[model samples]
Target chain A: MSVTVPSGFRASGVVANLKSTGKPDLALVQNLGPRHSAAAVFTGNRAKANPIIWSERVIADGVVSAIILNSGGANCFTGSFGFQTTHQTAEAVADALGVSAGDVLVCSTGLIGVGDQEFRDKIINNVPAAVEALSEDDDSAQLAILTTDSVAKTATYAGDGWSIGAMAKGAGMLAPGLATMLVVITTDADLSSVELNHALREATRLSFDRLDSDGCMSTNDQVTLMASGASEVIPVLADFIEALKSVCSDLARQLQGDAEGSSHDIDIEVIHAKDEHDAEVVGRSVARNNLFKAAIYGNDPNWGRVLAAIGTTDATFDPYAVDVSMNGVRVCHAGEPDQPREMVDLTPRHVSVLIDLKSGDATATIRTNDLTKEYVHENSAYSS
Target chain B: MSVTVPSGFRASGVVANLKSTGKPDLALVQNLGPRHSAAAVFTGNRAKANPIIWSERVIADGVVSAIILNSGGANCFTGSFGFQTTHQTAEAVADALGVSAGDVLVCSTGLIGVGDQEFRDKIINNVPAAVEALSEDDDSAQLAILTTDSVAKTATYAGDGWSIGAMAKGAGMLAPGLATMLVVITTDADLSSVELNHALREATRLSFDRLDSDGCMSTNDQVTLMASGASEVIPVLADFIEALKSVCSDLARQLQGDAEGSSHDIDIEVIHAKDEHDAEVVGRSVARNNLFKAAIYGNDPNWGRVLAAIGTTDATFDPYAVDVSMNGVRVCHAGEPDQPREMVDLTPRHVSVLIDLKSGDATATIRTNDLTKEYVHENSAYSS
Candidate 1:
């Protein structure tokens, strides 16, 4: 059997027993590279996980060699002890890979504030084993980084001379401005961190930051892009940026597809806004609307819920100057119901809402999913 | 049956067929005056409803003789047609009650942007009939203002020499800064509009604004306070304010309890915040969290969801310095898990969460409810 691989990246997955279930819960991905320029984004959440704090500092140097991620426990709110656990995990990975400890990034997602010494010890002892197990054909590493996700998500785009490959994991605690999503992208493009960082931020603003399935921001959300510079063909940076965005957007859509208890994926497009910022504000406001999400779940195209959501934002616009279209059918015009309610079709697996602000040319697109009973059942039944 | 009548007020409910369902859906309340001072609060939503726009302007004089409320059609976003409908409704009510048109306030809720000339004609033609049915003993008036509510909500409180009575109707489109809630309060205490307005704003800031069951603000939300001064008891203005707050709080709780499709009512209490504003911000963020609401639905005492919700707010404090308690059991303290997960009891009709900000002596309380399948079904299936 052939093992799947990402460009310029080597990966490994192992059972570190961090999870009592003894499931595969630990992963390691190394940028085996000539140039190690890197760009990363962390959760905007104020109550950030310990590993997020560690990785944020590590990526400041514009380079990283490896990332160690665990799925069983998010080392968050564990105080000083939790920070030590993150440090020890990174140190272990750094030592095993013969790299600087400061160059190794760490991420954890699962239960918060449960980082005991025993968990740290098991992680430390397993690092060498994980390093030894590293191979070019280890797709299982991507699978290991999932907590409640039903499946692993990976996207790869091959360009003329360079390739971008990425994997993401998240099922809930998903919202705009960065969800609980974790993504690692590896590419062989010869790009500097300055350009990489700028491109990554722009890509994220339209991709991960636009997905607001559950309207919750996780404490351990992180996205890192590593350039291995392994490819000799130097593609145009503009093309590379587009490729990066494609991967992130694909992963973000996958995250929404796997949203806990979700019945349908909904896309909200805010067009003719004052600017991108206003479009985002309006898009996010609609994406986080519970009534709107629920209406989609029931396959009901309730545009009134859409108007109510938009009314809450500070985005400058006359409510009466807007038009709402669902699934290509204009249901509302100038803030009033313009079409027969029965004309809208919302029972499909996917739904789209287009809100024409009629004030400017700016637009934004947000993706989310409907809330369902299964989401409640899964989160409530899970002890963590 | 004898209605739960509030002192110093007359009420009536009529069937005007504003809703396509042909249900009884218009209500009128008059402060049969010994004094006519009044105060009102409208939705903060920039896209104000037509009736809200009318009432906000009419009540500026601090004197109101009557209030006419209609359900089944929110005269919002109907453009100039909506403005005409609202105007005609107030005029008809004023004519029927023999009061100045400027002194009669109007409120409409339910479907938005569907009120046409025909609907206005039906309402205008029925005003005299509704007036003839007016009675202090009719509780059906409260029922008539409902759109999707499963039960009518009304509250009354008696002071030493004065009394306060209130009614509210809403189901979905509920969120912070005010939901779709429409509240009407009648008081027999003598007070100025200046004093009443100040008290109404302060009371609502802590009451209706704190309830965020669905996180969608309605265009038609309005809270009106009318004083009849029937008791001729002019207590200290501060006492009157306190009594009003008590009434608003009670009505807010009732609204949460009857939140559409809700199975559990959650009260999140934030303590030791930098001030009441910060506490309210923190509390409202949690109340608006879909994941947290789902966890409560599944009966899972997941505090991580709570932490994630609070992290999104700009409220001042260290996430690590926060403590969370669910139903009297400290589930998390100082940013770490403090007790066994099993120790918390979340399977109650009412759930309480106490968050200690540890920043100041200020505190605030927010009321909300768990998201359930029925809520989704109701909102989604209603139109279709």
Candidate 2:
């Protein structure tokens, strides 16, 4: 029970034959609510997919009755015909659920530029079947949205008489401002759309926004939150925000653990910076450095590469006054070798790199994965 | 006859036992000139090598009498002792050539943090042998300054009455603002240091500055030009600049061809941008995109990745109006799939990606290579 874990929500997953493997490839989630409040965030990439464009319009009015998502084709760079297909899918969902078409959202993921007439017909024909299969405690919706992911990611937060349930799917192309993930969250809290939007932005900024795996932004990424007044619990705004942040961060770590062909989950933390932005900039610079990532894959504590990477950023810091530590061992002190690199064990799957700028009091962390031969192989053979 | 192809230059390569392979690892070049005028550039990375820090002071007076370069150990992050080692090496060269230590520039390349007492002793002990072996026509200096490179890189430009000769060594870490390369250029033309500086800056800006094989910048990168005025004939400044540009561009291509663990040399050209900077920003974004690079490695014309890459930049362009062509096939036209991707051929060692930003009339090109599994292997096994 992922999206349907919350009360007043029904979800179903069905096989639409969008994938050649005959796996479940379509999902539908409906809100049987006294209040139809919703908020969403799309990919920051300018070249958005057709479904993303349609969903942005549906979410503008802060009311969503249902959402229909598909796997197999991203429906991006497919021109006006693809946009028509997304619109038709939403209209089908509205007709089946007896809701306004303007209040239905659409999402798609997989290969780009693959939307055709057959793709449109398969989704439109399955709407009725998906609506009939909806249940109050179904976990199939979590399985229908994965493309390259090895597992389903779901997180739940039980508050005071209120709960939030979320499911996310992504395996690669994870970077800042969100990855190639499609997420849907449902809550039984008595909250308005405006309040939900405020909480979601702050939550995602500290969670998904710090994950820079591979540093590749996607063209089709969406995270949505829907609220139903079933619980009638008017919780404190601060408490709600903290709960939401916890769920998002949990899902983000799950995504990192399942990233495509990755061997190590590395956390690059920057401390003693001029500000939060400076610390983030410094951490992101190291996170995106391919040479440094490859070194981590080889289990080499190459602190010099870290220095070289951070040197490229405009963040305020003295290159010679910085310190670097791996795990719990300080490898570099004041930009010189301290502990022997052999003392730092990197055989574990989790690696932590600590960088002290020795400037101020701000700090941040960026999560990334190592570069490996398997990573090159997976991406090289992805389309072929 | 690389750097010695021009007049008034004597160079030699000697064994210093710095490398485990028992190969020549030290090189010395002297400007036995009537007039010594030099111009040089170092890496823009803030975490510079100790040699770079010392050489910067030597080139400040626009006069350089000699330059010594070594391979097998980059004198970086070795503490103040590393700076002392660099200074001692320059002093050794100055004493041998009967010049001021301030007139000698030094360069080193290899694994960072490897300069120990033994490393310094080996270099200092071999200075006398290197000086005694110097000759005007020897090419040993070209062979000595190589780490992971498979071939010696040399380029020559013969003007009406004067000529320019240059040699460079770098196989990885090639990026904008120069790579991990150490270059030495010699000319017999009659020119002042001010004139040489102007021409060298312009030449490098259009040549090596556009070669971004990987997005990694190095802490030890330098390019130096020394004019001897041996020909005693002054040429037009514009003609000299054009000749230098040609030589630098030729050498840059050679570096791209020999880039470590690369199979295909890719050239991403952005056309009709708002300005040159925008064109460069757009081209470099695609050049550094690992997804696009891996797609090219698989010989797949995935144009959607190209659109997604350029969309990440702040360049002036409408994503919907862009066109992407691989080789001669326009795979994506006006943001929609036009020609099929199967029509494009990528079997050759060279691949071209053309992006038409239909926003203005400016254009730029960036050179890069495909991301391969061998790259991971080479870098992982390095510094071991």
By DockQ, who's the top model here?
A: 2
Q: After superposition, how far is residue B54 of candidate 2 from its true place, in Å?
A: 1.3
Q: Which ten residues in a row have the lowest lDDT in candidate 2 chain B?
A: B171-180
Q: How close is candidate 2 at the interface, in terms of C-alpha RMSD after superposing the true interface residues? A: 0.9
Q: Taking the tens digit of each residue's C-alpha lDDT, what string does model 1 give over A1-384?
A: 011233567888899887777777898988888888899988888888899899989999898999988888888888899999999889888988899999999988878767888878878888888898888778778877887788888998888877787888885323333235778888878888888898899888778888888777788888888888888666787888888888888888888888877889888899999999999899888888777777788777878778878988999788888999999999899887788868877778889899999889998998888866666676666645
Instruction: Indicate the TM-score of model 1.
Output: 0.95
Off by over 4 Å in 1: A1-8, A19-22, A172-179, B1-8, B19-23, B171-179
Instruction: Kindly report, for each predicted structure in the order presented, the TM-score of its chain A compared with the true chain A.
Output: 0.95, 0.98
lDDT of 2 by residue, B149-256 (tens): 889999998999999999999854334422368889999899999999999999888888888887888889898999999989788999999999999899889988
Specify the highest-lDDT model's number. Answer: 2
Q: Between which residue pairs do clashes occur in model 2?
A: none
Instruction: Give the lDDT of residue A14 in candidate 1.
Output: 92
DockQ of all models, two decimals each: 0.69, 0.80
